[model samples]
Target chain A: MPEDFEVNPWDVKGKVDYDKLIERFGTQRITRDLKERFESVVGELHPMLRREVFFSHRDLDLILNDYVSGKGFFLYTGRGPSKEMHIGHLIPFIFTKWLQDKFRVNLYIEVTDDEKFMQKNELDLEETRKWAYSNIQDIAAVGFDPDRTFIFTDIEYVRNMYPLAVRVAKKLTFSEVRATFGFTESTNVGMLFYPSLQIVPTMFERRRCLIPAGIDQDPYWRLQRDIAESLGFYKVAAIHSKFMPPLTGTEGKMSASQPETAIYLTDDPKTVRLKVNRYAFSGGQPTVELHRKLGGNPEIDVPFQWLYYFFEPNDQVITAIERDYRSGKLLTGELKEILIEKINEFLERHRERKEASKDMIEVYMRRGKLATVMWETVHGLSV
Target chain B: MPEDFEVNPWDVKGKVDYDKLIERFGTQRITRDLKERFESVVGELHPMLRREVFFSHRDLDLILNDYVSGKGFFLYTGRGPSKEMHIGHLIPFIFTKWLQDKFRVNLYIEVTDDEKFMQKNELDLEETRKWAYSNIQDIAAVGFDPDRTFIFTDIEYVRNMYPLAVRVAKKLTFSEVRATFGFTESTNVGMLFYPSLQIVPTMFERRRCLIPAGIDQDPYWRLQRDIAESLGFYKVAAIHSKFMPPLTGTEGKMSASQPETAIYLTDDPKTVRLKVNRYAFSGGQPTVELHRKLGGNPEIDVPFQWLYYFFEPNDQVITAIERDYRSGKLLTGELKEILIEKINEFLERHRERKEASKDMIEVYMRRGKLATVMWETVHGLSV
Candidate 1:
């Protein structure tokens, strides 16, 4: 029993090893050559890709090959609606929005309202449904092209999704899912069937699909690839990102359940400052004298990691900040203040877009390109 | 374990004992007092009920009490579309039609296209879907009032049914379903989730629901009762019928997979005669002289059981035939000829109605009362 870290669809714990995860999950690393190839297709890569934050991949080369051959690939991603949205939840969506812009491909966002209700005891169907609608506005705030994007919850669009979901579930057996998901006899049947629904959007288009999500969701794509080939569809391609470390320097990702430990997209500037100052873990020495003598470790510092992961886009500025922090020139208070300002700036713009998105939620939530492709393929509808 | 008979939704083997099944399923036998109560509500009982072939019940007394108090109940039953319908498959529909006509209640018929695809090894999604549409015409042939009846396949009506199905699935755990359905690790995840869909129609109406089906489907209602009260819905009442004996004199019911031992609703008169003459189990002695001297057994005779179970409507005529056969006055050939004539006559009328129903299949298949109720309840749709 290796207890150093555990990851599945439902739970994450301990300090995760990214390289080891790539090895264990049987996914390929995003090599320098692959990065250069991606750069050729979409111009200069996003900072997340350059910094290895969006670190690992499955079938990236194949998707690149298809794209270079004049065939395009769309994107698939999702959120489980159980609580409020945090900046950690926005990580993939922000990057995904960039990809959609660069590639001009359709993107489908699945809101797993059914999965939330099935997984949470206190969350009823209505509560989860309401959360899904709210989460849709947060996602729309990322500025996805409404004409090419579709956002659907399982309950609302089951008529379009379930026919294909049944086909996927028909190909799967209990033993196969149990092994893939580590499901026990006490697991609810809805959870067992849910991976099939999640897999449907990957095959929603005739072209290839590239999923941008945290590495914890890799197991579902692994199962999808095993069955996709036989179903006459392309295996889904995925780009896996590292977790956004929580403010308290937790080994795993930030979670919505602990409000104080996470900086939500909706959090005000004062709340962000208070959380960062009070709870952000630091790696500096005990005193200013000892701190100047012994350099700090930036890898374990939450404020520095947050900047490096998302906020600090300029490489030269980030390098200087890291060097100053490591040499004890930049105090912990200074680094915290830097992160707080950048986050508040981002949230201010995001809150405006979110408010403006209130009316457009219905547009993105309606049937769009991906839904048309799926309905046409499944029902022979003329779009 | 008793090997004399077997019964479940997916498989039936051996000779089933009605008495033993009632006890094993923990259901109550319909006593004369209950029969009298039912007679008071629906007029003189149908022959199927009077003969005790449609024998056991779960909560029939409450349904009758509600009916007497003018708080009515609706009928719910279904078919798994794995293959073409046989005469044995129509027994419940015929009896249910009588109940619907007598009580003038709304009826909801579910064609389990999803369950069939999940359970069968060779049937594909499209095949099962086609079978479901075809089977809907056969159900409509039973003369259900199209205005008051709603027939839906799991695939077509999932938009309206999935919300309630999720609520039901949340209340059930894997272990409970495995125990109830005898599901093993090899069972597909869809089969594990199907009972939730099957349980939805019970809660479609605000009033009580009475499901009339074979004893094989008892496990689903048993599960429904376990969670129904907590959900603030009435526990589904059910009327259980014995299986219609196969033409081959198999201990269990007729199967659609074996064409020779079963008479399909589409079979011609000559095919029905051939099946009855060649495959119908005989209870008479081997030699003609020995048969004339010795009495035959109507209790184990497939042809006699068929007449007693469904075809023959006259009790005095059936009794006379049974007595003549038991006294050696009627031979096996004579008994089989009588069953063949009765079956052909029944099928003639059924075929006419089925052909006539083809045009109205679209009408009966459209969104009706139950779908509107469910869609409004789940989606707040005003139309």
Candidate 2:
């Protein structure tokens, strides 16, 4: 029987089967040959690609071909500034930074402050704007090339995007977005019109735009592909990644409301250690003696899953840990300790970079080479 | 019996009854006392006001109270640049100019190029933008105070207005606009969101905003009144005018697609004379002998209506014309000649002013006192 799961841009639930999602969403799997092709061009694959964390794609091969042929491609991704940043929130940005570094191409990061305010009834514009500033700092900590990356918030940069957005909006009817986004008659007009703003950055460059985002966001890309070519731009290309499971279990993605189920980027070292020791779902036997005899199931473990998905990148190290856990050599406490240390180290480096990059955020948002050009130019139909 | 008429922002049909429209639209009649109050302050009433062409209002007394009590109000109006403008299109601007000259307050004219493009399937942004330029020239020819007036197109000035627009949009829902603007599910999202942009200028200043427009536009101001106080601004005030009847008949307002039913601002003397002589709906007997025997009905005559509405501003001249036409002293051909001369002379002066005020258009759009300040400010929630 099929696994019980649901996923969309707004909500995700239950245990998702990644391969089944590829079939259900009508996307192609990241086959071994395609991985080899990526490695051939970049000289090596990032850990996310090596481990198949990003396992689904649409028109990605075409993007690779354009890059190889010197036709070029660019990257676009975004954040909805509705709350504080968590570790799961940074996963796609970390992978996107790697893609930008290897390809030496431009990247545009849209912080959708306007959508966040319009989508949530309790959140106001000032609150979303505050979160937008803090989230931009976390994204900046991912170490993207400031000269090549341009970060913008929807409310601040809308003037440059609205002309093109209206053109895209005209091609779509309320019926189309209502079906694609599951919008209802009660949805505010601002929220209903927001998809066009989200689609504008993909057409910022003439070349193909490759988006590195969670699989749930594929619907927007599907809508963009339907209209981009008609507006004198290429259909957007996208690579989709599975969500990082919550710390307490592997059934679904992290929840921002449940503070215990996820680690925040601002969580201190002590909080990280305590949360891991107290809450990380273990697959070991009940007692110490029983775990030594029966061994642990690393396949169902949250700590091991988090490490394999992001924290631990070394192939040999992860392999050894898996082997030891399955053979009754590693205890549950010991495994939890490993994840705790890895998370604290990552958070420490992220915090330090965020503290030192106060001026760098300005570079990425306004004064950088790519950002300067974007601010001076208004994106619209070329014809 | 009630008149068989329809009125909305997008469509106007039948012969509108001014007295019934006031009751139907839930607006107050511009009473004789209000005209006397205007004369008390401004020394004399404008011909449009004196003759009751602008016959209805909402909160005109409050606007006057604020003006006399040392607090002040401003004027707001707009145009949809879907096609070339005609004499009917310039009615509100002409009255607004009179208000600005008398009140010496700021004026904001929104040229909605984006709305026109979204509302009409066949019109493109480039085409609407072309009309916006030509239409703004006609508005400038009405001779507004360039230092105090600011004219902006939606596409070009959206950056400054969008923040406030989203604030206003958040207070509205799809259901609300659908009911107010007659929007359906098939309406494009851009068109659904356009009422917010139109409402933004009403909140540009802290004092009340007085709008001089056709009664069909009352729905937009009504929506604005519902949400303005919640956004920390006063509810807008308005003065409503009647539509100038088409040349062919007095059944409906002039249409852009039916060129012979209206006189274009660019129409030369020959075209004006030909259209009026050929198509002007006469309220006379079928022949000259019968017309001399039975008096003409000036009430139903399109030429006499045009003179009463705008052309013959002199009280004595209009009264003499009305008396002579009612007594059969002015024949149909003679009355058409009088209207043709008035329109051609008006067109000649308009064309001359449009040609000479190229620099004045710049001042109203960008450089002069109010335009410069507006360009530097972004309107949003005051708190």
Candidate 3:
């Protein structure tokens, strides 16, 4: 039998079976016991966890155990800056910020400007750096704890990270990375060496590292796990989230190359309204009579899925919308209107915070308490 | 037909044919015309150039043209820090210092601590860094112009070079480095990425860059030459030297692994005398009675070769030694004693300078005029 879906760090195709991904990736599913453990510790679960959107994990149980035992863990997540970020790009950052706010631990946000430039033939360093600044602002607008979060680009912080990166790089052979990353002879050496830079922050603190990222990024952590203990650091723990479905249909994730399949953060209210009305995938019947008689299917509807995934976080409101849409009491146009309004409201607040937090970018990047300590120290394994 | 010699950046074996190497590596021989051009412009020639010790070149004539036209060139060379500094290791730096003194151009000395650590499985970054400091001191003792020389270790200076390294790395794939460096799938990713860092300093200046190094390092410059003009920089010029033969024989270069085959900078006078008598290969007859009748072969003697290559700089004195040894008037033991005395004198002077130049390492690495500018500037091709 041929598999219908494919997912990796660089590309995703078809509608993914999240359960199958957990098995394929050799990660544990977030069972009821783990969710209850999480709720007990945090006082409440984030909607993503409650809905099982953040569904799989590796070494997550040990991270919670360490936290409870008075030894803390840190958070690490990154973005590759190649183009303007879309709504899909904000998922990991938002969750990471929530984790930091609740745990009061350090958070590291790496902007991989070098990797992005090296990976693409047409993208130059300057262009990637420009996108890095723009993407960092949007991430800063997500309101992470400024004192606990340290955001850095690979090109800028390489001086501090290189010692540890080479240590990690030495442990990995071309054969190992080629097997893990699907790299070929044609892969640029910068991209080949980039996994070491990504692994550096996981060992930044002696305590366990907890990464909240898309399941596509799990391969890097897998490579990290293979060498972390040998290098005298704990294996990194990770919480893997499902991909945010594109607007056209719930097949592949949103891509920056196809503007119609994704909504940019800079999209205005009118543009969001137009896109939702024009391109949002609907599960309603062709005619009003048919839709009224047959009702709609909320399972495959893109707008309903988006609401459930991110925009509408209210449980009762989402449940009510789902119920009405399934009963034919709410039409496709009405559902898209609700999504458009929610999206515009989110973007408006995000844009406001982005403008207001201009000064805080520096605080998050360098002047914050965590950032200060990080800049003063060069991270590496102890002899 | 089996070739008896092998030479690469990492290894050299058997008796090398210099002319054959020129043909095999596709480099030009230092012709009489080029030698005259060098002597005319510099007002005199260094002994190494005059005797063809530094025998091959890539673009010597162009460097001269650039200098004569007021478009000057700079010098670059490097050392991989994995062991104590030895006499064979200092061959290029000694010659390079002479070039810098004559031409009065800036020189960049890269201590490749990262590459050394990555290349050897048993070596660690800290060990390489320790050797880097010691090796750099020996290099500093060569007395480069403090204001025009910048010596740096790759581990310490990666931040300043990474942006440019990635730019160079982006143009090269795994296949390219694999072919150039004989990299296998088992090679570490750090070693694969290191060629980029080695190529970075060649583009540090917009003016033509000249490298004076052993011919073994030509492959890296070959890769650099291929991409440099496209990056809007001049193709680097190089003058390549033949390796100093080991004390055991005139076959392979000196080996640090076999301590008896090489004279270390730290070897005492007593150790030098002992090593010379014990390990120096002789070309005279076994018995003294027969030796007086059978002449020694100066061409195959290690002591005579060493003196001709480096230690005995005076032309008439070396010629007398060669003639007397060839005519059997000078015995093998007598020749060995002469080499031992000359080596002790050289080592004594080098040790004195190494001790007195403790303060100068900082000047060459950070505080000197060129060092200060290099520390402030991040080298990259202009956009």
Candidate 4:
């Protein structure tokens, strides 16, 4: 059977196509405060100041415009469950987590089970639940505090909060939902209402919401901000990131569903070594001589981008690899060998904390929900 | 204040205008089973197989249609937080509580503290909680099983069940809601979503929703039914009562907002007697000769309507009252005396048992919520 078309910002490779994402999101003016917030999150100056992998923004100017007024908001970003969770997946989560810790405001890392369930034809809740749990671990591994963060399943809260869900449902329409989600006539009502569910924590009457995600999801955030005002609430803010290509295959980006295309969080050392060596989507030829004359194209080389995101806090190693590749002295296999060792060590630490991280995930989810829940309780329909 | 064109059904005079209600509901056939359900609940078998005050429906047909198709569904109904329910409020509650007992299906009754807060424009949450508890006792007086019934307050469940509410909101629009609730744009968003909140229980996959209200609320049910099909949901069934005119006052129905217009469930014999003798929308004449010739119009007498609702379970007393009233053999004072004695006895029994009944309400609320929570855990999103 043919696989149905399944492309959402949270899933699509083009989810981070910055220009198109901004057009789609209808966002504007990346502000100085957002940049400052970005700097505060990263803690140090970037190697590529002119090149922005973290792209697009909304209501960012408002924060800057109000900076002298001494008011600020919080941050939000999330995952669509645990599919592969490669380095591509970590860019936004890690950065957003950093922003949250630095800013000292509420953070909400939503796990979009309801989005996945509605987008997928099958109602395999267990798979969704599994994906949620695994993705939560990845989020926790990114290091958000249990006290300041929140994660929740749609079904869990839908059961717990009938009145609130109903209030949100009334503010939206099929036309608006379809516009936001790219829903077709065949789209389920669940999907139609799904965006509002994501946006709800933002309006919370009290907790000002700031979203962090790849540029692709900016459309959803923009829709939420508009609807919030209609519901008589505060406009939400967001930080958007650029796309990171998968290391292999022609599927456009890294994906666990396509094994050769991406490296898993649990990738064994040998597997990582083999995958990088064999299918890193090289810019160089099979023979070294042909490649020396032609030179390497940095744009399409997945290994270079991978190094940028993962070979962090160390320029000596990253520069050496870049110098070797520029001079045609470092063979693709040699680079793979280096990444294999680097990635393996990273996964080793991840696994060490993976079991201990269950409590961490629980804490993020519980705390995140508590912040929103507490605010919602006090301000609810009255606000 | 002119009260912005008052239409509170709690203010209906001697014969409710069913045709006007049906015209407003805009349905051709409300279905026979809905009427039968109401009759079964009200304990009055209409000889004409007639539809009375409850002239509109939403999912009443869906329910009838479901029953016709041999599928079982539960009934849903609830009340607002009346501090101490008067004789007027029990017309719907007693009937709905009976349906819960006979049908052996799930029942959910919501106490709308959220609605009261908006209506009274007050913020005393403790008083709302107090009213929730107080109203529960009056609800328990009708005797529903604690195991089968669930009672919820807007404050308690809104946060947990907002997803269900989101569905309701999606199916309805602001203009549509305004039309149902009779408000302008300045009305609180909480009131805008009030009908949707009332509706969340109907979509309760575990509990079938059947609303018990007055004909004044018919517009809300009519809109709910149309939207249910649009959203692929079962409609809420309804049992609407003709209004219960007040014990005192010169005109119209009982109203809690006006102290003289209602008989509180806690009123003692002295209060009942005094109020009845002095106030009850009299049909008596100023002169003895004129009264003898004109007699009394029981149809226009508010006390007779109250007696019919509260005092006469059998036809004999009603017929005798009617005959004496038309013949002028019964003075207005005599009729008032009968009503006062009947209502005093009724209120006394309720007051005596209220403390115990209040305890039962708490148990019912906890058990019902537990059942609903479990159902959603295993079965997934119901209204």
Candidate 5:
């Protein structure tokens, strides 16, 4: 069977070509000038931005213009509770936390439990809700400020979200949704309406919103941007990130379904070390003699890519590791060992924070100041 | 051009054939046996059941069986609130009130403000919500028990409905809805997901539920029954009513869009008289002498149908009216005058109750014991 390798809100397949996708999706590239402008505002870029992993954008220049003029923007992102969070699932949340801290902005995280239930045939509503609560542990562990952040599941916070969602759904027709997401007759009606819920956060505040997510989700914002201004709001801005490569190779992103190809946040250090040693795809020669003679390719190495993407943030250290690996001085096992150590160290603290978050989840889950302000703005309720 | 009489939840056109619709829709007839069974339980039959205004049903025998066995069922009905409520819109509400009073069961009234907004191209969310509140006034005038009845609009009560709606949406695909409603690509996503919300009231209580609505709404219950037992609930029972004939004729039902043909509850007695005198479809001779010699067809007279359906509940009086009209002793003007008197008297009381209901709406509007009970049942919350 032939695979289309298409990327949309529902499906992700094939080895995605990022530059081609930027063109196909009609999003603007993250130019060098924009990077400098972003760095100036944040003091320093997060590693994801610095490494070009946060690659493409839509209306980002306008958001930056507003931010530069002292008109701040809020952050919006989400998770679908289909399964446990793997290491790859943390990419956007980690970057969002950094963005939140650097910009001192409010962050709204939507848990799309309803979407997961509608999309997955095997999962029940109760199961999706369970995963949602568990995933909140991982999300809270990323350490967003309780005062400036609000986290809510769709089922629980529908009272706050549904009014805006209905407004968005009113303007969208089935043809537009099908054209945007390739939705066919088999798609559930809730999944068709799910984008309306996703788009609600973008219009939550009357001010600008900057959504940070993988490029796979760009189609949603495209639909949102098309209908936003007519609904008496600004078009949503987005900072698109590249998928974190799976452990086996760069064919696709890490997946929770393929447990062997990803490391879970709850995995013990020993398990992490074992998985990294046994499954991490190497770019070295078959023989040590040839590797030493011809040198290895760090460009295609999964361990090196993971380190560069998130784990090893120091530029000098990363440059040294890349150069050493290219010269065959850093063998595959040595590199895997280093990558495993970095990942385990990060996970150790994350695990502790996640454990603590179980008791404190309600603090972050409350309908706080931002929700009240947005509700008032949308409903025109006099305070 | 030839016209096809089409009827569904969203659109109704041409001259509907009630008997053919019951056959095409695959619902059971409200036979003499069922009518006797109903009257036995209620001790006196509502005019609708006795006159066969509510002409068809599905699984009503099961509900009656449960009622006989002491396992009571609730009543579910709704209004779209697209416009002002005309006298014709009172068919289901008046009958539902009778069911609630006789059966002593809970009644859940869904005011589908979201549905109205999604289906009407010209109406906005705020306008639909305004109509919903206004229509609630009319619904309240039907005199449902405040303690036993709960009325909710889709937008305001989404928190209570969304979880069950998600479950229903999970089991329903676009194909099923399209096949059921003949929905094209032009349908909005909200319109597609609305059946899920419509079906939630059936599962509000763990016991059986009987939905009293027009036959136009049978498609929604058909979808609901197909998936009900799989969700661990009984199939919903529905008693379907015929459309109240438009004042102009049997061409369509009364519509707020056509003010000349509809007697709105808010219409003044003089306007009601003017509308009936000028626009009510008449089956009489051109001259009084010709009518006295030839006689009139009481079966096709709009005024006679309205009185027989609801206003004039006396069987002997209705039979005398038919006999007099057929014998040319009663003219169309006299029949219409009698209908006008009956309608004005009914509206006078309805308006008084509606006016009084404005101050008392909060009692019924509050999320009372049943809402909390259902919420706890769904979420397993201890509060």
Candidate 6:
């Protein structure tokens, strides 16, 4: 049996990988340029499309078909503030921003502060709310237009949206929530109703909202979309992304808990280089001659995978590096230098775009909530 | 055992010596001369007392003690509104009106629409609301001042006057409500919360209201008072009247379903006369010889007991009839004739009051509500 089979699910860094997953599920990768098709399906594409990490979607084509027939749909994604935000938190926002900018779709972002509180007790409600604000700022930094996007903090919205929320809560039973969440008999009422909070935003209107999430949460979104139809809600489309893996290992994605596991946007070139050299998981032959025979397993190497995720300008460089490393031309240290260079250049661009970062982000969030709040108020919920 | 030992509790027509009731319950039968003393305890004896139907009371001395010491309490009673108002509904108002006039105390008349709806499903909510207004008019016709009285409909007041109802609902489990109300799993949620609704209005504001009901409902009130302490509500005071058996053979207190069981204030003189002659239970034997031999069994005879409840005009006349009946001189027909005459006069007076009724009653109801709405609005729940 492969040593890889011994990894426990929870002990993995933050999330699991896609290719390994694709192999596990026996699914093919979506390769080739689909932007023109997506534009016809959705409307437009954001600039981030130079790399297609948001590579899979359900119902996008159908909604695009509907839109071409002069129909329109809104956009929705959830940010569960259970932990501090990392750059990975931006993945859904990144796509959602693109969807919003290109299609002019109304956007709804749910800040699930209450869900975070029930999930972990050490975080008080107020601090968790701060986490929500921090996370929204991060999402806003990804460039969702303020006028079209809405950000809802669940606590404030729930008080004003009691009638609609109660309607949803009543239709869902205690046992159903328990079965769905794997909750025990001791689970509190708040926990029992938390999933209904997510369901609420989707049922906001008889229209369109796409949920972009990691594949693991596909099970939950699938349940939500099914329940929505039964409760007379517009079906929610799900856009699934590959898990962004941690620097410490390719066993899984980076998590906020371990600073070394994540190559944070704030990391300097020295830190990024040290982090990759010291902690990035890799496999090589015991000697250079033997390494030449083994070749680099790009699939298992975290740095190579990150280089693929972020190193947009030089696919040819990575491809040549892949060739050289596999045939034992370039060594591990040489591969690390190229990855460090790629990340530094990426951060430098991010820094350049970080002009008026805090102020601009704050303004966007405030303006975004106005549109969101206004729409929510009409859809039987208050912001 | 004496013949009285076999008294049929349901029979009301012949006679009942309430002197026996006062003796059995250890309550004092207050005379008209103790007008000042009666005024002190249950509050001022109403002009309805100038007529005498509300002839006796419990803890009169104690209540009088409290009132005389400058300590004040309020008047409280409520209607179930299970059916239309009858002349019978005027008992509380007549007594309450007297108390209001004498002691100058505050009055709270609760119209229990929530309890009625919870108990009976066939009853229309809107219809019960109409019935509440009609019942309130009848209560006002008894002549209460606008400033001194508060009448709240439970459906509205349960939502407005007390957060205590919510607190109580939280404390109760389904099983607890089931045991208390004999409810099953099929019982609806609103029905399950009925007891809490009743208890809240009883102690609406620091025992600001005192309940006036028949003795049989003592169990419900006692239970409410028990639960109130746990909910942090002030202990409510309850004044229970002896049950007045229905006219169905005069064996029990009047029930709405049985046509012959009650005296409707709307009853024409002919209907009153026929009901008195045919249905008021008789204690006289089947034969005049037997009646003369045994004398009228005052215990089981319904009309004489009713006289104790209603025929308050001249005790000398009442005492004279009692003596003549026990002495076997007063025929059962003669006794029923006297009751029919007395009831006709009483009904006439109420009818006249009903005739003079005007829109001014709403003014009193509104004034009563305004006096208390500000205080009850503390939880920000009032309309």
Every candidate's DockQ is: 0.61, 0.58, 0.69, 0.09, 0.62, 0.05
Off by more than 4 A, model 6: A1-36, A39-57, A263-277, A284-293, A310-318, A334-378, A381-383, B1-383
What lDDT tens digits, residue by residue, belong to model 4 across residues A1-383? 54322335746643234554466457664545556764654475353321356556676555444433556676667777636477677767666765666566667656777667556644355667777777777767777666666666665654433344444554555556556666554443445546656766676535456776666676667666766765566788765666667777323557767788888887888888888888888765567786666656545567766776554436786777777776777766666666677778878887777766776665555545554464345333332
For candidate 5, write residues B1-383 as lDDT tens digits.
46469888766788888788888899999999889987887698888888999989998889989998998888889999999999988868988988888788998889998888888889877788889989999988888887787788888788777888888887888899999989878888888888899888888877999999989999989998999899888889999998888899877677789898789999999999999999999888889999999999877788988988888999899999999999999998999999999999999999998988875466566755664454345421112
- Candidate 5 lDDT over A1-383, as tens digits, reads 66446778766677888888998899999999999988886689887888999999998889888888888888999999999999989979999998888888999899999899889899887788889988999998988878788888888777777877887887788889989998888888988888898898888777899999999999999999999999888899999998888898877778888888899998999999889988888898888888888777877889999999989999999999999889988888889999999999999999888887775577678545654454344332111
Interface RMSD of each: 3.6, 2.1, 2.2, 8.1, 3.0, 9.0
The prediction achieving the highest TM-score against the true structure is 3
Ranking by lDDT: 3, 2, 1, 5, 4, 6
Task: Go through the candidates in order and give each one's C-alpha lDDT.
Answer: 0.87, 0.91, 0.92, 0.63, 0.85, 0.61
Q: The CA-based lDDT of model 6 is what?
A: 0.61
lDDT string for model 1 (A1-383, tens) is 75689888787788888888888899999999999999997889999999999999998888888878889888999999999899989989999999988888889899999999988989988788889988989998999987788888988777887877888888888899999989888888888898899999898877899999999999999999999978778999999999989888858778899886799988899998999999999987788887888868899999999999999999999999999999989888888899999999999999999998887777777555555554444421112
Residue B201, model 3, lDDT: 95
lDDT of 2 at A291: 88
**CAPRI verdict (incorrect, acceptable, medium, high) for model 6:** incorrect
Lowest lDDT block of 10, candidate 3 chain A: A374-383
Off by over 4 Å in 2: A1-4, A381-383, B1-3, B381-383
State the fnat of candidate 3 relative to the true structure. Answer: 0.83
TM-score of each: 0.97, 0.97, 0.99, 0.67, 0.96, 0.54
Per-candidate Cα RMSD to the true structure, in Å, reads 2.0, 2.0, 1.3, 7.8, 2.2, 11.1
**For candidate 5, what is the DockQ?**
0.62
Query: If both were scored by TM-score, which would come out higher, candidate 5 or candidate 6?
Result: 5
Q: Where is model 2 chain A poorest over a 10-residue stretch in terms of lDDT?
A: A374-383
True contacts kept of 5: 0.74
